[model samples]
Target: MSAFADDTAKDEWKFTLKNAYINRNFENENLKDTGSWSQAASLFYNSRMVDTPLTITDKPLKIGVDASVQYAVRLSSDKHVADTVLPFDRETQSQAPDYLKHGATLKLGYDKTLLSVGELWLDLPVTAVDASRQLLTSYWGTNLKSQLTDQLYAEIGRVEKVSPRNAEDFQKFSFTSNGKTEYSDGLNYIDLRYQVMPSLKAEYYFGNMQDLYNKHYLGLDHSFNTENFTLGSKFKYFNAKEDGNNFNIDAQNIGLLETLKVNNHTFGLGYQQIIGESAYPLPDGFLPETYFINWNATGFFKKDEKSYHFIYGYNFKDYIPGFNAAVKYVYGDSFKTADGKENNESESNIILNYAFQQPFLKGLALQYIRIDYNVEHGNDFGEDRLFVNYTKRF
Candidate 1:
């Protein structure tokens, strides 16, 4: 039993449990007795498909289904898993346990056009996506995309809040009054993407974050790909205002990357800088992804921030009979109002990720994160995390 099980009144392993139910339902109905369970099984499959991505082929009408389950454990409280000081807890146990972790995405695609609805994992204006650290966060929405002409295309949609593992079995947040309290209302946004040229793409986004935050985003991405080398650059602008308050901010993020691939080995380098104005850092609960990788590193670092990261990975063409290992490192700075004083401080952190890929067993990933923080104007404490997860795809 996990330590959190003893600390909390309810079983914290709901996610794992729900995952079991979903899998068993599929096996028993679809495989055990196809004729008797046809209707029920089809409905179950359709729900899964509604939330998954559909690949576009030559056929306009296409259908497919897929799902995955992830079992994870965190050995340390270091929330942003990296190699750092250990957490203060006597037993850093699993935060979310035995949770049903699966979603199905569907596609209604035609020609160069596609429509997707159901549960989705999104990376939009970069704020919300950057801030979420969990691997699986799903949104209920529809994405309408089109390839207008040969080189131009666009995407648009609206989504609910981020739902992590065990979401189906958990009690979700709701509101009695319109935007009166936190976690009561869902977020809505519009995103646009245009490919101006073969190497460059531009994106614009606008959204209302319930009653707490309103935001705008503009970004440009350029890529250079060749036989053995790839280089990429991204520049983004984020503007946000606190709802029902006299607070607003403007921020800019510039990122550059270069990668060299040799057979099964690859090396890369990256850098990012944030500049803006705000009295204090954004709330820790919102936007955490700007700090780390794994797609869910919520946006916790505040505005007026500057950070850098380095990555190194090598793939063995034929190692361990049929497996490969990859590793990455990230380091950067965070800023916030200094200890309730009328000053601010610059914090630093280091994060790392390692994964082992085996053909039959799929892949197992381990994440270590550490934030060594301090205040230029006062006392300081930091956070550390260690996480391990297993993933299989068919």
Candidate 2:
């Protein structure tokens, strides 16, 4: 909550504060209440690395030093609704919810690109933060992002360490799943996007999880207007296979979504397929990362499975200019056991979001969500999430 700048410099000093409150209850009458608060400070300065005018970025010589801290607050709440929500394990609370630094980044910018070295943050679909959690995920490594042209862009990086959203300490990056697997030296990733037309674009992503797996993703998206209606369609294909000496993981995933938007109303339909002998793995832990965003409550990825969902969204912008809401219902079928038995599951989610447009609260936002899951074998549950955030640039 403080700052200082050089007397003769144009550098901008920045600070940020965020807070969120979460309450989750289960079908078994289990209730938990918690809150997370975060703060950050940084100095964006000029670097003399290149004396030439900018050719690729906003400034010819820009550098920055940024750091962030966070705290997790566990509120006193009853967890005896029915007590079946989850087994309480004192051994699991190995670390106290204390004040801790989550991010520290050294950034350099030139031309139209910027590179960051040291601890950083990622928000990709597969290796991203679990926003429902109290804190954000942080990674340690180097990243380079550049705007190559008006219609093209690229991001490349190598991250060897990670401090998950809910973890107290950093851990070596690796693929985490239902089974314990050896950690790797981290992961490598690159993403490229090209605008094929004014309203159509394509994106490709690549990731190598050390010797465990390598993943490839290709997606195409397009949106256009017809009269007062907006129509959009998105398609993505994914491939993950064993890499190096690893032979226990392999999978193929496909996703398709179509949407129609009119005024403040929007409708969407989505389909996803999972093919292969093994389930696809995303990073996980108390501080996990996952992205195969096909459903409201789960990834819906199972051996020989196909999933579908429909979504409805409304934006009060036309009515209130800063409010929006959405709901989605998802179903998964054709799950197969090793012997090929049939299993099924269903999920649904309700969400509401709003951002304040008033001058004093211009950067404030609030969101609420609920997700329900029903599976065979008499297992059914629901999760509720609430988030409040505020951000600003100075």
Candidate 3:
């Protein structure tokens, strides 16, 4: 069964349980060893999309609510470790407490347009919540989206505060750059997508962080299918500038990715370059969107950096049912440090995933990931992550 209830149903609730284990071994050249291991268990409850009892202008009102709680413990003996291993309470310099997050949203539809308010999980080119960890981020905001025309869609939204993936409470939009922390009152964004043709699409996005920074994105995607294989191409560009005099930031990012798929095997090649004096900046706790092809355990967005990556993936469903594997390798160079020195970095990842197809384990899934990262002038690390998840709808 699907995780969400059928739209025809008046109301429904779903629950999920997940367990995760992560371990990292660091070989630092300048700092002490920061290796650590951690374990976490999370429970999530979500209400299916349902219409409310109220209506406006003959249109039905819709609402949704989602909540999650997580408990994590450090398995390694070290109390001081990287945030990826375990978050620490800054004030007390101790382990962080259990986490709780919840959000509710109401949507009103009119024709081809929809307006949503209250808590939201936004996924835009410029600003998006990060859900790669034990919990996902949520925002207090309002958004409006509309199908402007037959092939064009538009969206505009404003967010006031955010509850970060690792944080327990909501806070103002803030990010740290060049050893300084800058705070923003709020963030506003506009997004547009257009289907140029049957096989091509174009996108544009602009975002402004009040008194902080401004970001603009442009992208194009196209695909071609043939009898033997399918080929896809993606191009993305970003421009970042300081919004006010409070901070100084200027950067641009350009990336291109090409992919080919032949039956169960997929291959990809990508290149990304940063052109400016500063690194590409994002919200402190958020992850890079799809435009950033070189974002992995570490982002290759340093000053004047150029990166190249390759990917290969295989699906075993034809032979081994519900199994898949992938490997990615990235190398980046030509980055300048604060002291005028150049540095380089490399990252490699291997992933294995399986989902049970048997009736008794219908909703069971398992995944394992391994990452190896090395930097010419920084720390090197090897990390492993394992996840066991099960879901049921009632």
* Candidate 3, residue 205: lDDT: 91
- After superposition of all CA atoms, the RMSD between model 3 and the true structure is 3.3
State residue 217's C-alpha deviation in candidate 3, in Å.
0.6
In order, the Cα lDDT scores of the candidates are 0.44, 0.67, 0.76
lDDT per residue, candidate 1, 1-394, as tens digits?
1111121222112121110100011122323210000000111222211212443453334333324343333322333221111112225532322223345556564555656666565766523432113334455556666766665556676555444322322122232222243442556677777778989988778766565566677777788787876666666556666654433534455455555566676666666556666522243223334422222132323455555545555545465433344444544455555454333443344555555555554455555555544445544444444444444322
Better of 1 and 3 by TM-score: 3
Per-candidate total of colliding backbone pairs: 44, 5, 0
Q: Could you give the candidate ranking by TM-score, starting with the highest? A: 3, 2, 1
Choose the strongest candidate by lDDT: 3
Ranking by lDDT: 3, 2, 1
Instruction: List model 2 lDDT by residue over 1-394, tens digit each.
Output: 0011112334443444445444444455443432222232222222223233434444345556666665544333433322211113355532233335456677676656778898767766456755555556677889888888888988999988877655656788666555566677878999899999999999999988888788898889999888899999888888888777645777898888889999889999989888887776665554332445453446678777798879999998878878899999988888865565677888888889999999999778888888788876334776666667776655
List the candidate 2 regions with Cα displacement exceeding 4 Å. Answer: 1-24, 28-61, 77-95, 286-295, 318-321, 337-341
What would the per-residue lDDT of candidate 3 be over residues 142-200, giving only the tens digit for each residue?
89888888899999999888877666667898878767888888889999999999999
Judge candidate 1 at residue 190 and give its lDDT. Answer: 73
